[model samples]
Target: MNDIDAWVWWLVGAAALGIPLVVTAMPEFGMFAVGAVAGAIVAGLGFGAVAQVLVFIVVSVALIAVVRPIAARHSAQRPQLATGVDALRGKQAVVLERVDGSGGRIKLAGEIWSARALDSDRTYEVGQAVDVVEIEGATAIVI
Candidate 1:
């Protein structure tokens, strides 16, 4: 096909690749779509079919090699700001009622939470400060 037609086809292929990327939420497809745009640019510049294909392959492979690992590392990392129950761990709370091995109540993060002592033999009296160690279901384990 003519150079203009070839470039148009490459752009169409890029759009096609984007569909699956959006549907599957896979970054690889988006990378390939970008490569297709690179091929379209080469074709619009009047490069031969072989050169266009080579640019597409090189760009796609480079993106996958470099960006993929960075993306994976970012996804594997823990969030800097803890939320929900995780935010409660390691925080000090005031006992609202006497806390023992069986059950009690505490004001944690400004909310009343069901609490129990981390050490079964230990106990906390009202207004005493305790550290939240963990959350099991709706209950907070404290010490």
Candidate 2:
């Protein structure tokens, strides 16, 4: 266009990026903010209103194309609980003390915790093999 200057192209690109960053941070006024940035770029470039519209369109398309794949990967990833017990679920542990049934303790992952027998009659001896069936609070239920 007659009024557009190439030197302001960098400013136009910055406005395009900044609008969405501000929008992500404060979504309520996202549309207004985008419009204002687009308007600034168009006026600064001494261009027509069509340039204002193009700023918004190009910014939105570029944002979606760049962020869509990352978003998809984040959504598909599994979450792991940070607790150590969750890491030991279904893993074998050696009983350090005969499970008292009401509340007993076991040594697992170099840590001691309250434990319960999976079967009522099952007697876990010291150094005997046991599989962690469930973890509840600070206790592990084993078989």
Candidate 3:
């Protein structure tokens, strides 16, 4: 195909790649779409098909190599605020029943929860406050 025709085809391919990126919300496809656009640009500048393909490959691979890990690292970061059962840890609760190592009950986060003292011998009387140390199954380990 002629240079203009090849560039148009490349631009069409870039648009095709972009559609999936939008639909799937996948960053990789977006990166590839960018590479395709780069290839189109090179083709418009009168480069051969081989050179255009090389540009596409290099751009896509470079983007994946450089951006993917950075994206992954950012995504893998721990949230500033805890959530769900994790948020319960380190929170204070009020003893609803006498809390001992074996078993008891506490009013925690607006719900009643089965609880046990972190220290085997420790006990918390009703109305006393305790800190949730961990959760095991349906039970809360507290201190």
Candidate 4:
């Protein structure tokens, strides 16, 4: 924006931010509002029509720069990490091999995944009751 527009922008920002702060802060500083108007007037005459416009633009830019990241961070927190194993969390899969405490294979969907028991694999038949405990790297720990 041109200097005139920028100066006006600065004026608006100052007024908006100042009004709320002043009204809540002292309530007696009615002088602040009057001073703002007077300052705008004096600034307009001394700096020409362009000063307010330039100030406004600068204030707007600074505000935007400061607030943008906070907004993005708030949004980012909404959805950050995936389910599990980077993809599959509580998904069902067939037992490709008898899982012991060590490791075995689970056939989930059409893909085969390595798996192991969460605790102990004392007696786990090739085809028996099992649950996907956790997924690590390219493997799924099962029980």
Query: Best TM-score goes to which candidate?
Result: 1
Give per-residue lDDT, candidate 4, residue 36.
Answer: 44
| Most lDDT-accurate candidate | 1
Scanning candidate 1 in windows of ten residues, the lowest lDDT window is 1-10
Candidate 1: where are CA atoms >4 Å away?
Answer: 1-4
Q: Where's the lowest-lDDT run of ten residues in candidate 2?
A: 26-35
Model 3 root mean square deviation, Cα atoms: 3.3
Tell me each candidate's TM-score. 0.84, 0.58, 0.73, 0.47
TM-score for candidate 4, please give it: 0.47
Across residues 57-82, which tens digit of lDDT does each residue of candidate 1 receive? 99999999999999999999999999
The lDDT of each candidate is 0.96, 0.69, 0.95, 0.62
lDDT of 3 at 41: 93
Error of 1 at 79 (Å): 3.4
Candidate 1 lDDT (Cα, whole model)? 0.96
Stretches of candidate 4 exceeding 4 Å from the true structure:
1-51, 54-70, 74-84
Q: Is candidate 1 or candidate 4 better by lDDT?
A: 1
Q: For residues 1-143, write the lDDT of model 2, one tens digit per residue.
A: 65666435544655565667675764323444454565566657677667766775665556556666677788798885646667889888888888846667788888887899877777788888788989988889998
TM-score for predicted model 2 compared with the true structure: 0.58
Instruction: Supply candidate 3's per-residue lDDT for 58.
Output: 99
